[model samples]
Target: MTGVNIGILSIQGDVAENVSATRMAMDELGIEGVVSEVKNPEQISDLDGLVIPGGESTVIGTLSLVSGSLKKIKEKIASGMPVLGTCAGMILLSKKAKDRVVGEMEQPLLDHLDVKIERNAFGRQKDSFEADLSLEKIGISKFRGVFIRAPSVIDIGKDVEVLSRFNEKIVAIKQGNVIGTSFHPELTADLAVHKYFVTLVQKKN
Candidate 1:
């Protein structure tokens, strides 16, 4: 592929790790272009796809809103830019977020994915752990999912397809060009999810 530009939103999250994983995934596929930690609206427009890494949802939402990237991101997603949101990123992408540990406050949400998410669905930081996710529906054998104060998809709209589930709760979902996961795929060595996302980007391009 030529001139592929992917960005990992670095407002407040696991920015560097996602950048490294995305770059590695693109390199593995022999795709050449740029992988950057995007923090500004201008940088966002150059991106073919965006990755919102797992982090403190409240902080990420508020900071990005104040920085003016939140509105830009919402616009880009509306214009059909592919996006992958993991962990707290899922909260930002969700249409509604319930069960917030902290009291509800105004936070910028892209509302790209038609789902209701519950923040800290996997308990607190001490409850964080790794699990082998069976994403058979997405054609994956097993994915090592890292859950760090993750969010869970409590409800998904009819247009959304449940990609993977843990127990009875939907943990991964895809709707059109948007992908959202409750666990962190970048935290693991597997890059299938990221590669799958790139393919979506390529198709959209």
Candidate 2:
């Protein structure tokens, strides 16, 4: 079996950890593939899937736009490229992003996922917490999710499905081939999330 080629957006934040988790997941699944940091849009090609890691959303988005990667990302997503966004990545994918303390910031977004998000919805870094996510709707139950300065899904379009939740708030969601979460799955030893994302990538491939 030809392994899936997964690329982690290396623009900023948790890139190395994501890449490691993705590789580990693939190994556990006995899938042959490579996971590496992708800094340019040109690397978008031949990638079975892409991961937008946790980071400063505004900075990553602005840098992507400035570096001409925003359009490429949009194009890939529009063409049905499977993507998994976590943490600040959620803000990049969201069509609407608001601040929990403030309200909105001037940040360029890929605008692929149809949802409204609130940055730092969980408060400060000290408010970072872990919870057993209810992702049973997607055949996953009790996923240990780590949320750090995460964003919350306030509103989503009808096409979006709630994959997981915590404290009555939407944390994990799926829309078509795109999967987004408010937590950092890579930070945990559990590889289920990455494994699931790889499955999505395989299906799309």
Best by TM-score: 2
Tens-digit per-residue lDDT, 147-199, candidate 1 = 88888888778999999999997999999888899999988889999888877
lDDT of 2: 0.88
**Stretches of candidate 2 above 4 Å error?**
none
Q: After superposition, how far is residue 100 of candidate 2 from its true place, in Å?
A: 0.8
lDDT of each: 0.86, 0.88
Cα RMSD for candidates in order: 1.6, 1.3
Candidate 2: residue 66 Cα off by (Å): 1.2
Instruction: Tell me each candidate's TM-score.
Output: 0.95, 0.96
Off by over 4 Å in 1: 100-105
The 10-residue segment of model 2 with minimum total lDDT is 39-48
